[model samples]
Target chain A: MLDYKLLHALATVVECDGFERAGDVLGLSQSAVSQRIKSLEVRLGQPVLIRHPHLAPTPAGQRLLTHYQQVQLLERDLRGSLPTLDDQAPRLRIAINADSLVTWWAEAVATICQEEGLLLDLVIEDQDVGLKRLRDGDVAACLCATPQPIAGARSVALGEMHYHPLATPTYIERYFPEGPCKASFQSAPAIVFGPHDQLQHRFLAQCGYHGHFPYHLCPSSEGFVRLAAAGIGYGMMPQLQVGELMASGQLASVAPGHFLAVPLYWHFWRHSGQLIQRLTQHLSRVMT
Target chain B: MLDYKLLHALATVVECDGFERAGDVLGLSQSAVSQRIKSLEVRLGQPVLIRHPHLAPTPAGQRLLTHYQQVQLLERDLRGSLPTLDDQAPRLRIAINADSLVTWWAEAVATICQEEGLLLDLVIEDQDVGLKRLRDGDVAACLCATPQPIAGARSVALGEMHYHPLATPTYIERYFPEGPCKASFQSAPAIVFGPHDQLQHRFLAQCGYHGHFPYHLCPSSEGFVRLAAAGIGYGMMPQLQVGELMASGQLASVAPGHFLAVPLYWHFWRHSGQLIQRLTQHLSRVMT
Candidate 1:
């Protein structure tokens, strides 16, 4: 059987990003933390970490960390059933897209979290890649655009997030004086969420403009909307998030008929405890 | 002189996270993109990237990237002077902490961005580490807690962000019925931003607590406030961000007459062009 104490040391080292910080977190000496890692490596008969350029876990280390997290979940389940074991509130580590977190997620999950005495460790990732957090065992559950679940996990459709190509009226007048067309799109600046965000590119393609365009990359969801509302750039604004701005006449759709509806899914391990099950149900009921 | 075309290929590959996407962005075939990378490596007489585990630049490659970014900044200055050269707006990549981004940054820079026809590429990083982005040449400027400037850079104090240990009324009633003390803090949950965030820890230490305490990690600035207001956990919240919540009776300080003031600094290259100069003037004027 594998030693959980050693696994915990590995997890803490990776989490803290160095042996010194891991020691601070674990209340162990720096050399002691290093010894624990070495012991784990010897027991496994393989090196678990790459320590040269930066402290990154090898594939073997990642698998062990994942296993440790799963075991932690099971232990939390046991603790839930036995109240005398520990009175500490349970923590649910979840990977959620920034759009959802900014829009409906907090309001939807707030009640359940409060009532259940649960704490949250939220990882904000792009919808396109949020599922990777689940696959890598960095999170217990994830809300992502992908519908397919990895092995041992189940995915439930939460609903769709509709995005429209939106810009301020003055911005439209300035950039698209002749109305949005191929030539206009080539010159007009767009607001992209990040390098991995393809919403703008896809929206431009839908408008029959498949050409290089200049864009401002704002990683924050709130910042993205602020940049658009400030007339800095046009971008794909989610209907759920931009309702207030749209209603205030601060933003208008550049493309009248075209919209992108991305379906969101909640992915969680099938055997996850009551908390995951409850959250999944809550998300589906509220979002759908 | 180094070939700028090769450097552009390198930057795009790093930005896109793969050669295939970089090719699409660059309007080149996948093999052609790969060939460009090879040519650059041959010219340098060393491997620029480690492609196995993930595509990451070597230290030498990083220096080249930094040089390329600096050159681009200089070129943008030249284009600003010669308007007919290119009508494209200049892009300024900046690293900013989430608290500033959520509280004052968007409003402060919105007018300048709109008027100057400048585009922002904002990277959200913790204030403690934001200077590293500036040092690595990933950003033109950065807002961080560090007052010390690197070589060729100037650091100016923007203002102070005061953080108070806050919690919802009901949460305080449940967790700290006898008022906040070391024993209560040991049992009561706290909301932390992430591993690197030390605000909560500092606040706890100030409150005369040094033992281990449980915390829920929430990375989003807006979400962190929401979590605290929802009665999930107590946290160190910025006064700028929680004034409305406090006014509404949703949040209140757990510890009276205690707060952490993190001084904000704006760090930028001393030799940057007109746009940076204007921004620096605007920030110093408004923030102070």
Candidate 2:
């Protein structure tokens, strides 16, 4: 057995690069840090340091420090996820993309946990980046498309969301008047869910029309769908999100057969974790 | 969040059934368990039980209880493995099978932890059932062939271990100079590692024989290997356990070109953790 408390002190010293500075972080005297390190080596029954005026960890000590870092990360995640299990008040923290948050995704997240009694800390950003919150120790888990296992984390696939080239029936009729999709879409003004979204470009590439379109950058997802429904321009939208508008004739998909599709995936830490798994379960059922 | 103390108390109640018996086990008044359950539901904002003369948990309550049981098992395992990290000489608790303890496996386990500065407590039982020690909160983890994933646990395939029929070359020559493996084997005693071991049965079945072997059960892994080495009787042994003996010609494998390969998997609670992974790393390198 080794003294991790002393090892932690040693790590702090290596991190601070001075005994006095390490003592300041550890709230110990410089002499105490040095004494602790000495005692740790004795207890290990092995020399674990090559002490110098400028503090540095030995090979064995460095290995112990790496273990210490992993333990620290695990402890932080446990602390964040188990606040209520202890004397502390419970809080629910979630990391999700802005597009999903602004769309119907929040409604799904809210429905699952609201009645269960917890305050949620919603971390909203782009889907591509928001998922890093889980890895960076900012949140317990996240929803992402990258899909590869995150070291110790697990992922479940949520099915594809089809996004067809959509526009208002009148916008299609009046703008072209050459009937639906007859006039090339290469010159149509398109609505974007966000500046980062490339669905329109992808659709045009598939249509073999490499020409660019004038874009309306409506960052909000629901707003983009509304702009298309209001007959402003053509945009790709998921059927689940726009079926009612399509039914009411406010929006008519342009060449409904040609659609863009993106598959979604949910990733989380693999544990007997009720919260993350339950949330993933509900979202997968509804999305798929 | 669920109250762990309450769930444990409820489990105690279910195990005992009567409130007085449950109280005795938990060292609380019967009234305390009842009050605890009431408060737990209020705190969680969810009903977990409909108390009667004997308690029966609701569906949500059962799920919560199961999670608590997993937490309890991991906590116990942590306690056992934690002492190993302390050079101050805290009580060391280790989980192992009777067969391994009797065999060279115990020696390996002892030697591996000896220089590491651990105060050891080794609990021994049959490998097939020693896992109950882990699940019931007795030991940290054990070497088990159980392939099913236990709640809160993970499994890794350690690879196949080939067990061949072996005996002292002298004993084989003296007992039956000419092979009448089926007829002579029926009369010759077989050395069994433990009561539940299937190697002898499978071996005999291969020779078109049935019924039980005239058995001498040595319930220790190292002892089983040593017994066969001493010309005690013919028995099946793992290649890793007997590979050195075979190389030295101290033990000759009777079923030379034929053997049974059993793929052993390592299972341990996720929280009990990488200890099992470390063991698997060492065992796989040699076992294969």
Candidate 3:
């Protein structure tokens, strides 16, 4: 029989699409990620990935991932459940993105505790990272960014987290010397939240700029908003993600009507625990 | 950390409802059935059953049984698949009641082969026994008598298998002998398919007859019909099951319009391979 722990490791590696990144997400070493995938392939006697095109999972890999996703959710639900029903509240663990957790998720968890008498634990990470936690047996549910759900989680398009390019007035006046680059400046530098995410690059690429930004790597969604607000550089910020800052004019929209829309998606473990249902019901209310 | 396998065994036992009968249905010794359940509770660190009131599974046991049912279907689908995709015909495994296997299931399988290039491994047994086979991982799909589906399987009401209590006209004339004793004579000696099944008994029990019938266990559906034709005993035979014998006047309806109707249900692996889909589709046509 194949080692289950190795399968879990391989699953995380595929989700992250890079050995080092997957290791970072799963709290393992790069060598450990590589070794686990290697061991899993040796055990299943099949190549589970072609390992290109940004790490597409092979059909066999997809099948195993699907099963793994399902089993992981069930196990999480079981763990979160009260053992055979008791007087005490069940421990409810939820995986959620930094944006939602700091925004409206706390209210949702509070409602559940007050109404249903649930004990809650929250994991606040990036949307993409929250999914990794859900997959790695860390939490019962998560708020994700992508519409396409990670293998086993059931996803609903909560709503898009709309973004508009913004910069401080001084920074725009100094750098652009123009409101927003008219017809795409191929040579302009920019700031971005994280290393792997290319949202800013993609937006610029749409206008023919192919160069990377002198990036800030502000990991948290709130930190990214703060970095953009301080006018370190022109960057993309979600409407809800940076709503108050934009309204206060600490950040100004550089591109008046040209903000690239990054649609946000909420994914939770498929019926894991009562707390997840409570969160999703609440998130759905504000997300739309 | 409980023996998940015991949940499986308990599902099997509860599905069949008797240790010895469940053993025969599962192809295990009665002692093996007891041992499997004992080991399951030991693993679970809890007693799963109270051994009374029709042997109910504990709440945890019930939940695990539901999961086991889903797992079994997924496992069957996985096993039915070939090592690699090829243009060749795929083997399909199905468990069907003897009456259905003999009457309509063959034509349905033939139709599936013609349309989908399927190779079938047909399992013939009683409907109750077929469900047990499904529970034990014997077949990828089954045509069962019960309307309720096994945990992971999908079910459809395939209408009724109209049965007319049949025997040589001479047997009714001799047994009844005179008037005013019709219901009394109907509950007399009967032909049951096998020691494991109680279809005939159910019919009598429903009619409020608490007495046992002096019986013959013919085992095969065809054999049961033939013995009924020759006047060995009265038995409920499906219209498709004894249609030709009745046409030839070799078997005449002993009860005529008063015979009981036994409904047949289609149960297939919820995540079945291509063949199960094709076969169940055709069965809806013939059995309906």
lDDT by residue for model 3 (B1-288), tens: 555556666866875556775776567899999999888777778876656323556655655664665555455455557445334334344566666655555344444444553444455566776786676565567776788888878888887777777777776776645521436454344666654465666666655565534555444455455445545567778887677778988777654555666677877766665556766777777665
lDDT (tens digit, per residue) of candidate 2 on A156-201: 8776567888887766775656633424564455766543466877
How do the predictions measure up, each by TM-score? 0.93, 0.35, 0.36
DockQ of each: 0.57, 0.01, 0.01
Instruction: Please list the residue runs of candidate 2 whose C-alpha ends up more than 4 Å from where it truly belongs after superposition.
Output: A1-90, A102-107, A179-183, A271-274, A281-288, B1-288
Off by over 4 Å in 1: A52-54, A81-90, A285-288, B52-54
lDDT of 1 by residue, B188-279 (tens): 87989888898988998898888888788888887788777767788998999889998998999888798999999999988877788899
Best by TM-score: 1
Task: Give each candidate's fraction of reference contacts reproduced.
Answer: 0.56, 0.00, 0.00
Candidate 3: segments with Cα more than 4 A from true spot = A1-288, B1-88, B179-188, B206-208, B285-288
Q: Is candidate 2 or candidate 3 better by lDDT?
A: 3
Ranked candidates, highest TM-score first: 1, 3, 2
Positional deviation of residue B219's Cα in model 1 after best superposition, in angstroms: 1.2
Model 3 per-residue lDDT at B27:
76
Chain B fold agreement for model 1, TM-score: 0.95
On a 0 to 100 scale, what is the lDDT of residue B43 in model 2? 75
Q: Candidate 1, clashing residue pairs?
A: none
Per-residue error for A83 in candidate 3, Å, reads 66
